[model samples]
Target: MLALKAENISKQYRLGEVGTGTLSHDLNRFWHKVRGKEDPYFKIGEANDRSSKGNSDYVWSLRDINFEIEQGDAVGIIGKNGAGKSTLLKLLSKVTKPTTGKIFTNGRIASLLEVGTGFHPEMTGRENVFLNGAILGMTRKEIKRKFDEIVDFSGVERYIDTPVKRYSSGMYVRLAFAVAAHLESEILIVDEVLAVGDAEFQKKCLGKMGDVTKGEGRTILFVSHNLPSILQLCKKGILLEHGLLKESADISTIISMYTHNAESEDIIPNSNKDVYLKSFKSYTEDDLESNLQTAKNGVLEFNIYSNKNLKNVKIGIGFNDDMGNRLFTPFSGHFQKMFDLSIGENTIYCTLDNFPLKSGKYTCEIYIGDNTETLDYYDKGLIVNVKDNFTLEKPDYSQGYFIINQKWTNERK
Candidate 1:
């Protein structure tokens, strides 16, 4: 049985404004419709590529998307940031309507699209729980039966009577997630909102979601950047790129494609904002497979674009393990080398005598900021693959990522 189906769904948005278009464009759309012509702006939309400046005023956040979720299936939606993952979730959650196409879904959907979604700030946590339950079509009595369990799971019992506005972001997400999960909704739609919670809470929530699908046979549509958690909870995956359905397959296959794609996830799109990382490149210290070889000399280059000249700028680069923990991060300001960014372009290169990471896949983190404000920060600045050593067949990765070279010889008689 199909739990949900989306057919040719596409979402379009004007570059600057929220609603359909400006008055002139609206009049154009109206004029075309009067003549029984297709919408003019519909043909004007370009793909949702954030990295480049486009000529079109309209962009398709999602285009011609078609997919189906089987009943009781937990499906993970994987994509880069700004790749229409959240837009698709919002459409399915009915937070917004698609510009075109249809979505057919079975049963009630409880969505945690963002922190404190559907929550009224004036309402207390306890009141908000009931409010969310009501929104999910649960009777007051039904909520009462599950109320204690929800409270316990959230671990926010002491603050249940406090106005949710007074609660911390962490508290708000915990209560919100608990309410969504405990309610008897047949379909659960969760965005990357769980990232707001601490590690322990995230783990707890992941476990509950697993049970919701495997034990209770509920359907789930989850969108998250955390691939390991996605693999653990979802049996299948849907990959989207530039607002189009790129691939739909088992979770493992989707993960492999997402990681190994030739197009780099390292590049941050050019922003209309003040400044951002334009491109990141790992140099020619690659092995035979064109992968970054372990324990080899290399340079990481960053080309940053800025709308205007900036001062007191500092660039920080983090070498991270696969688990997203920074092994070490180097900061420019620490060396009293506060760099300057020209109005148009700035280039910074970080060199390594021997690449630090062992043979593994790692992520490089980049942050550019100044004394007062942050210019740009890319947590997954680069997804790096470290293969065998340039010299050794197998690099020594015994105790840690960094290898220390050593040698001993007999002294004089």
Candidate 2:
């Protein structure tokens, strides 16, 4: 069943001043309306490309977007900044109207698009919960029935009676999410506002969203820059580029396309005459290139060219998934080790014993520096692909990203 559908949706905004300009564009539009013809400015509007300057005053934040989301399906809307991600969410949430086309939805929508979106700053948290519930078409009886659960989930019981204006940003999001998730809204819309929360709180929110979709059978539209979270929570993906709907497909395919096209490996040069990264590579136990396969014992090696001898240098490596979501970062300082760089060249190697990463493509980020300043940094320096071996049968990617070696014991009663 289709829970939501958007047809030829587009939103346009002026570049600088509001109201179409100094009465010229407005008069032009009015003249077109009087003649029963299409607006002339519509044809002159340009795409919302933030990187380049356009000649037109009006830009389309979203243009000709068409998609259908099935009931109980979680869809992730992903794109670079100023790619019209938030604009689409706002259009769907009715925060703003599209300049053209229409949207149809089957059920009530509760959106947590931003911090304190529907909150009244002067109202108490307890009052705001009832107000938001009422706005979502819930009766007072229903609000009261779920009030305790919402307060408990938010973890702001002590501040429930206090005015929300005094609450912190984290507190605002907690209460907003609790109300949006717990209330009887068949569809939920969440933007990148979740990035404001801490890591543990974000995990908890993701778990709650999972429950909402899988356990309660609700529809969700999530917009985020965090690719791992999108991959973990959504089954479908919609990619937008410069206000246009680029692709809509299964999550994995969309992720692959997005990552491959956006992949970059540029080494940043430092101003100081210190150490700089020259090359980085990974090798398997067989001394073969680790681009495809690596044995249990693999080595990540890098070379640094230095102008002068240095001591107490810090080196760090970050492992990220294809979509540029960092999984883990290991630093030399964390191991209580100091690095010394010779004047000409220096080599550093990190060994992976019994590499636990599952079969997948990963990117490596390299950083070389000291406590005071950074010498060199490379984003997506090297690409490593881990292949599945005969070590395990039927590996599960959903259980976790990596395979943990652990002993299992059974007690028979």
Query: Highest TM-score: which candidate?
Result: 2
Poorest stretch of ten by lDDT in candidate 2: 262-271
Clashing residue pairs found in predicted model 1 = none
After superposing candidate 2 on the true structure, give the runs of residues whose Cα lies further than 4 Å from its correct spot.
Answer: 264-329, 338-359, 363-413
Model 1, residue 243: what's the lDDT? 94
Give per-residue CA lDDT, model 1, range 172-232, as digits (tens): 9999999999999999999999988987999999999999999999999999877667877
Q: Residue 36 CA error for candidate 2 (Å)?
A: 2.1
Separate clash counts for every candidate: 0, 0
Model 1 spans > 4 angstroms off:
27-31, 262-382, 386-413
Question: How do the residues 161-239 of candidate 2 rate in per-residue lDDT, one tens digit apiece?
Answer: 9999999999999999999999999999999998778778888898899999999999999987666678789999999
